[model samples]
Target: MHDIMFHKKIKKTLSTIEEVLNNNNKNIDFDYLLLDNMLEITFSNNKKIILTSQIFLKQLWIATSNQGYHLLYKKRTWICIRSKKTIKKILKKEFFIQTNYLFKLNLLNNI
Candidate 1:
């Protein structure tokens, strides 16, 4: 993908995360910080899920409490090549494992 498109995707993804967290802030006990190239969500338990961008590779990555996934642009979605899972899927699963809170994200709409 082109640099602009890759960056746009990353922005959209982070914004989606922000929207979800803001909407569920009362129900979910978590805090988040958005940086120039990264988004970090910290749970009440102190576990974190972080997303970062690799501009040179035009790629996005997610680091959960237990594992990390490199997301490649495929079919207009960011998907893990090995697990063939979308970032949304990996995030939902991992957050539940870490915090026992089911994250409701409209990332599919962004996709």
Candidate 2:
């Protein structure tokens, strides 16, 4: 289990990241955090959901087999790709984009 202080830090960092994403002017619905080398995110698709990944997260300088990052921002879906090779593969393949954000207020909304 994680301590309250640690969780608080993650929450704060997520807020900052949210501002950064929202500034992008896309319609996004998610919050994100960096835990060690992994990123834990809360997002919504047809509905709300949560997800976790340990790779391909550039915001925290972590990369795995994946190469692109997707998010909902400014009411639009946007993708940030790290490498062109990975981007090409992801674009060529038919894959479901699974990503979102979970903010402090989002918790309340879920409740």
Candidate 3:
């Protein structure tokens, strides 16, 4: 029961992230983790979120039923949002893709 709810939340969150990333030129970093039955998502800005990590995809499933919100994080701070509602709120802000000089340099060097 709880497992189903958790996966739906994760999928919703992931979908939102992917959508935002696709629309923006700013680079977004994502570190996915599973600790003690919790799924942890660490963003490049140092924001993190912990939620139940379970796989639930039934024939009749809905994602919006779960909460959604956004979280703000620094370049490498530790922040966690436990619900989807919070993730949505955070994502509403301006999103940018971060490109490091080193990465650009490497790309240039390669080219």
- The whole-model lDDT of each prediction reads 0.82, 0.34, 0.36
Candidate 2: where is the Cα deviation over 4 Å? 26-111
**Once model 2 is optimally superposed onto the true structure by TM-score, how far is the C-alpha of residue 35 displaced, in angstroms?**
16
Q: Model 1: runs farther than 4 Å from truth? A: none
Query: Which of the predicted structures, 1 or 2, would earn the higher TM-score when compared with the native?
Result: 1
lDDT of 1 by residue, 1-111 (tens): 788888888888788778877876777788899998899999889999899998997778888869889888888678897799987788779878977777786655546
Question: What local lDDT does model 1 show for residue 13?
Answer: 77
Q: Is candidate 2 or candidate 3 better by lDDT?
A: 3
Q: Output the lDDT of residue 4, model 1.
A: 88
lDDT of 1: 0.82
Tens-digit per-residue lDDT, 1-111, candidate 2: 135533443344344444444553255555655554244444454322222222323221222234434421111112233342222233223122443322222221111
Q: Which window of ten consecutive residues has the lowest lDDT sum in model 1? A: 102-111
